[model samples]
Target: MILGKCPYCDDGMIEVREKEVSGKKVKLYACSNAHWTTEDGEMFELRADASCDFRVWQNSLARYGKWLSYKDMKDLLNDESIEVELISKKFGKKTYYNKHISLNPEYGVSVIWD
Candidate 1:
């Protein structure tokens, strides 16, 4: 499925593909020109012609114990001031807090947990 346009490259579109791992199916999202590979390091032919390396894991987009939808991810890519509630674990306890999420080309998605 096409999630949205790529923020890194002018002519790239973000696409999601499914792959089976450990007897389970998982989705991997990446830009059309992304040099992404499967979990086993197997590269996709469609992604071989690379211009951008924007890729993200499906589970990595989760916040507050819930996975974000494609639209939500798109919104996050567009807005820098978007804050998300995140659940943190410390001393066997769960704590919730809000922080702004940012997409770094070198670091992927991240938020200030500290």
Candidate 2:
């Protein structure tokens, strides 16, 4: 249960562990205080019920170039009526201006180019 500060509940620490999700083993972090758990290390929490065709989004981003912007995904997901929970007050500026947003390669959220 090694963890850093809880991304969801800043007051509590996080506990990193592996759990089966959607039939796959995912290493997710859970808040020590039971605030939240996520496969993305709590970078941002996309509600489990969020509905959006990830393939469509991935294709759309590919057309633009390499790397998908968080804002782009957030906007589309929001339009699709998917709720996104942000641990941080704002989507970090790192992805602004095609700066390449990071995604977990294991999750296959987007295609990777070698």
Best by TM-score: 1
How many residue pairs clash in model 1?
Answer: 0
Q: Which stretches of candidate 1 lie over 4 Å from their true place?
A: 21-23, 35-48, 61-66
TM-score of each: 0.73, 0.29
Best by lDDT: 1
Q: Model 1: per-residue lDDT, tens digit, 1-114?
A: 887888898999888767665566656677888764455544443345677888766666454564555765777667764577778777879998777777767655776555
Cα error, residue 35 of model 2, in Å, equals 6.4
Candidate 1, residue 81: how far the Cα is off, in Å: 4.8
TM-score for candidate 1, please give it. Answer: 0.73
1-114, model 2: which lDDT tens digit per residue?
A: 433443323365544445554465544444445433366542434455433212222332343333333444444323432222222224543232322332332343433332
